[model samples]
Target: MTAEIGPPKSANPEIVRRYARLLREHGDAFNVTDNQTAIVRMSSFASALICLQEGAEPIMQMTCRDRNRIALQSDLLGASALGVRNVLCLSGDHQTFGNQREAKNVYDIDSTQELQMFKMMRDERRILGDDELEEGPKMFLGAVENPFADPFEFRVARLAKKVSAGADFVQTQAVFDMERFERWMSAARDRGLDRKVHIIAGVVPLKSLGAANYMKKKVPGMIVPDHIIERMRKATDAKSEGIRICVEQIEHLMTIKGVHGVHIMAVNWEEKVPEIVEKANLHPRPPP
Candidate 1:
């Protein structure tokens, strides 16, 4: 039997409406910013909620760095109430990477724990307060994976654990080494995760030699090969070249069997999403 590939067909009417409006107004694609360390801040969450209310499928990325359980629950509930259904739970970047160097780190719960909490709330119909209603928010829970992590043997197991804990989908760390990623996918399949979860590969276009070098040295678990570095070096105008590279990367990623979609991390270049999507020929596959 052929393995099922592509996003699930379920869609909430509110989510659909939001998606349509975003496309009509801003073009046909969008993603949340990853540069911010604390994604659950009221301002950031409010802005994201507005995007969802406008009919965009805002993938609200929640991090464990800034919020305790109270704050996390408040934001999650708010997101659900606002028609934001998809979530990407993460452990977040260390404080040293952000502008706020003195900010406190809250690993009160890691990504896995957070995933489990969401699942419990959804399944049991309860949160911290008994007065809260039993019917929980609908969410397409997602998690992140780094294929380049050491002790490669643990990667598949870790992915399996996340799925078991209730991750409906996964977005991998930026993939410059497609071969290694492909192998990891194959192993994940052999371990039986391929049938259970959707995988969206992360692709970030190199903006310049400085950017590429910075990611290699500063960013954890991100690797851009020398050839891609060379390509960036040869481009006369780095930004345009980066966009072109992103377009090409998405095109190539979409062709991989068992691949569901591509998550574009354009950083702050949100305007470039639609162009890359159009160039790559990725449309919402009709619900199967």
Candidate 2:
């Protein structure tokens, strides 16, 4: 799972401890986001290093929103030096969506370029600009895909681009509607993209109906089915109901043709991660 530092992304002592709990108790490794939502906080490299010191593996993120090609390659090498063996490349959310609406969002290289850059650095032993590295970063590279994203029919094709560009694995956005997700997965399988990338399905546990409504309405590239909202509304305990819903999603995800595992996004309800992981039978994670 790609665990958040915070919404804006932080690297405080408390946030580090929370990360430790998630990694040591409930998950295999945690993802360190790169200025999520474009609101500045600690660097993903720093957060990942912190996770490493705490005995947790980190998936370092490098988004095209903040760095140019030079900075991107440099930061990736730095991450490798700090023992971050996994990297997730992404095109960040627009700056207009963040608290700092006026900040310039640099997409000098879109997400696909980010993936290709990481691959070139790792596999070719050279940066995208053709500078050679003595010893390239031997890292497991990843990319993000949101099956719930618009033009859903083209989402699988985009996944194909990621794989062809050298993404070793992929973690999709929070998947609430298994039906739609399966449809996406089917197309991915049909094109053989699933065979090429480790597909980690993302899941978010709905803490309350308010959260559900917010995701349904506010979140872009998200698809939260109305039945889930109705279930949350009728629940005697919304929290417990959320857990059950997450578990249900996990089970359904496991049955899909090419899903390798699940990435549980606990969000604000991070403390409840252990519960969802345990109840969903994801824990006692296999030793690395």
User: Which model scores highest in lDDT?
Assistant: 2
Over 1-288, each residue of candidate 2 has an lDDT whose tens digit, in order, gives 344444235446667766565556567778777777777877788877777888878888888887899898888888888788998989988888877898877789988888888899898999875989998998998899999988888899899999989899999999988888989999999998888999999998999999999999999999899999999999999988999999998988988989998887777677777777888787777878
lDDT of 1 at 140: 80
Best by TM-score: 2
CA shift at 131, candidate 2, in angstroms?
1.4
The parts of candidate 1 lying over 4 Å away from their true place are 1-30, 33-42, 128-133, 283-288
Q: How many residue pairs clash (N, CA or C atoms closer than 3 angstroms) in each of the candidate models, in the order given? A: 3, 0
Q: Model 2 reaches what TM-score against the true structure?
A: 0.96
TM-score of 1: 0.83
Candidate 2: list runs displaced more than 4 Å: 1-11
TM-score of each: 0.83, 0.96
